[model samples]
Target: MTVTVRDFRPADAEAWVRVRRAALPYMVTTPGQVLYDLARAHPGRRYRLLVAEEDGEVTGTAQVGLSHDSPVPGQGFCNVYTDPERLGRGAGSLLVARAEEYLAEAGARSVYTWVPDEPADRAFAVKRGYEPRRPAHFLHLDLANGTLPPLRDAPPEVELRSAADFADDPRPLFEADAEATADEPSDTPAELADYDDWLATTWHRPGFDRALTSVVLVDGEVAAFSAATTDGLTRYGTAMTGTRRAFRGRGLAKLAKNDSLHRARAAGYTDAYTGNDAGNDPMLAVNTWFGYTVCATEVRHVRTLV
Candidate 1:
């Protein structure tokens, strides 16, 4: 069985999406979103999608790119996934090799990848010279069966609204997202300086459910928000849940997330997922309040391209 790696083609959308969803069930993805990402990637990102085929069947996929948006330079990322049933057939290793080569050529000094905390996945990264770093947790909530916290009364000056209400001008939503993202704990820090790029890659993404995204307004200003992403079916994810700097410790983030989850369950989504840095106690506490349990853990692994 010969496994070959090559650049992803438009026709490989379905198979690629299948492989990714199978390997990483915690994230939301679709064929159209996959294609859009490939076509709309930032020029500075140097992004590339690769696929591994064995005997004419695609079994593995990889997303390789530089951390162009990060304030820190020389950082890159390469995430690889293989069909669970096709593991150990050399497809994963082949995809990783190709991804590293591409990233190295694109002037990346360090390549970071996420490896499941499971034994085999960790072994694979270790064998490839990658070292373990900070860990992240993927939490799951059975929206269909799990009981969500009742919506508490908002502060007298606070009002709950949907992201859709700001369709005419989402700059305020973007500002809230930027502030919250800047405070997120991660190995790579993001600087959301461009409104146009955010509009193209985030606001317009296929799975983003603006109607379900809950926002808290304090006296007519954005205070906290929980962004929602879905597959237009049974799957739902919390793309981002954050409170602006001034709103910290006010419990507005929790209110927004709770409202979003209730809305999602009402919309018939069965599975809900979210990820958080292990060290983020505040968000972790919020999720726990909603009965979210740790479904899986993944550690960030990095290797220098030198």
Candidate 2:
């Protein structure tokens, strides 16, 4: 049977989740998430979810898009993942080829993707003209069984709150997030300059558990935060965790994450997952202290398009 690649349809949500989970279990996602992301994607992102099928079965999935938020224009991305059981059917190659063609048509000068940190995966990217850039890791913690650090009281000037508290005005959280993201290590940096876009693509994203998200306030301002999403069953995920520039060395990030993790466990979630750049020592140390161990690693790769 031959493999074919096409734009993802609303009905293909389940199969997309199935293949993504099989290929990258550490990145927790669901059918609803896939649909919400596809439907609500920011217009500037030019996001397209592609699915590869073979003989009526989904063999792989790819997220192809132009990074319009990127500070550098003409940048694109295509992250491809194939089901482990569907290898050697050319699903990955087909997806990448199609993705590249779309990106070029969309005015992209370079494309980026994350390749699993393995010899074969590296070889695959090299064969496709991708050059390794940086490394990142997916981490896991047994939220239901692992012992989380005992909750500690914050200083009188510092207080803990949930993202729900900012329901009327999430701009503060957005400000802190933007500042933190500005300094975050990445192959292609993005500036969260548009508040409306953030509200659509991130703050309002499905499964974003505001009640489980912990925010640290210092002097009545958002100093740090730990945003979260859950499958509403057993898997919990850290969407992002960061502290403001002035609060970097104050251990506020740990305070934010610990509070969120405790809330998640109490909410009946058993598995917690997060990711960090290999060079992000401070964040990695925070995760390590919280019992998160490296579950998987992927290297960022980039290829210039002629």
Candidate 3:
């Protein structure tokens, strides 16, 4: 049977997550998260989730969208993933073709994607005109067996708090996220200009564990944070970890991440995962110090549309 690419449907949520998990186990996501994200996506983003189905089974998925929050305009993205067991079934090609067409229609002048570091995957992107850009590492920590570093007491000037503590007001977290995100290394630099959008997408995102997300305060101000997400079962992941510019050298980011990781282990999460750009030395060092090992790598690929 021929593989068919179509817009994601409500019924495909479970299968979509399954295919994504099979293709990229390091990235944590769930069926509810997929549905919630689709429902709450910003209209300006032109976000469209595509699924490639073969014989009524989802074999691949693609997240196609315009970079609405990017500093550069006319930029788009299409990250495609196919189940390892379903390779060579043409699902990947169909998904990418459809995604490109959608992106072009949405007025994108260039598209970016992350291709797995494997030779076959790199060849697939190169054949489609994507030129390699930057590389990123996917790190994993064996939370069940590996030992985490001892949690150190925070300095008298630093206070540790969970994201849940800011239930009445999350603007402080947003401000810190924006500041840290500005300094992140990436091919497509993003700026979180709209607080409402941030609240809708990040703060209210499904599976975001506010109780496990640790924040560091310096002199009563939000200085660093480690946002966490979980499968509500045995898996835990760090969504983002960063420190404000003024607090960069104080080790506050490490403090927050350590607190969050310790909380996750105590909560019965057996596995933890995170990704880091090759250019981000500080973060890579932090993850390394936490006993995380690089499990996979992916190269960012970009193609200019004429």
Candidate 4:
């Protein structure tokens, strides 16, 4: 069967999510997310969602875009995934080739991609001229069966709140998120400077569950938080968990995340997923303490497109 790659149509949302969930089960995705992403994608980013179809059946998908938030220019990413059951059919190769061409035409000097750590996956990327870089792992917690740490009472100087409390005003949450995200480990560093952009992209993301997101306040100031994104179903993913600079060493990260997990279980979410760079020991220990085990690993790879 011949494989063809083309721009994503609204009709392909369901199939796109199906292919992605099959390839990356730990990541939460839904048809709403697929449409929302394409609708709200920034023009500067030149984002494109491409899919490979064989005999009218979607066999692969790729999210190709520039890292518009990064300070450095010409940074691009192509996250490609093929249906596990439909391998060796040239879907992945065609998708990668088309995505790379799109990035090059968009003036990207370098393109990065995530390839699973498995031997064949790594070999596929290396053969396509991608050089391995940092490694990251997805951790899963069986929320319905796993035991979460007992929620601790906040001290007199500290308080815990849900992100929904700031529905009328989310700038503080954005500030806290920006501060925490600045120190995140990544191949392309992001600078979250524009509040309006963050509002449209991060805060308004379709799956964002403000009520399930937990925030820790030190004397009424945002100190740490665990942002959450959920599929309207049973899957829950920790979007980001971090403590501000001054709030470090107080265990606020663990406290906030635990509170979120406990609430998630109560809300009927059965699976919890989070990702961390392999070298981030502090966050890894925190996840381990919560009974999250590594479920998948993906290595970051980069190729010069100039």
Candidate 3: where is the Cα deviation over 4 Å?
none
Q: Model 4: C-alpha RMSD to truth?
A: 0.7
Could you tell me every candidate's TM-score relative to the true structure? 0.98, 0.99, 0.99, 0.99
Greater-TM-score candidate between 1 and 4: 4
lDDT of each: 0.93, 0.94, 0.94, 0.94
Candidate 2 overall lDDT versus native: 0.94
Candidate 4 lDDT, tens digit per residue, 1-306? 799999999999999989998999989998998898889988889999999999999989999999999999999999999999998999999999999999999999999999999999999999999999999999999999888889888889999999999999999899989998899988898989889888888889999999999999999999999999999789999999989998899999999999999999999999999999998999999999999999999999999985
lDDT of 1 at 184: 89
Residue 134 alpha-carbon offset, candidate 4, angstroms: 0.5
| Tens digits of per-residue lDDT for model 3, 1-306 | 889988999999999999989999999999999999999998889999999988988899999999999989999999999989999989888888898998999999999999999999999999999999999999999999999999999999999999999999999999999998988999999998899999999999999999999999999999999999998999899999999998889899999999999999999999999999998998999999999999999999999988
Give the range of the ten consecutive residues with the poorest summed lDDT in model 4: 145-154
The top-ranked prediction according to lDDT is: 3
RMSD, one per candidate, in order: 0.9, 0.8, 0.7, 0.7
For candidate 2, the 10 contiguous residues with the lowest summed lDDT are 37-46
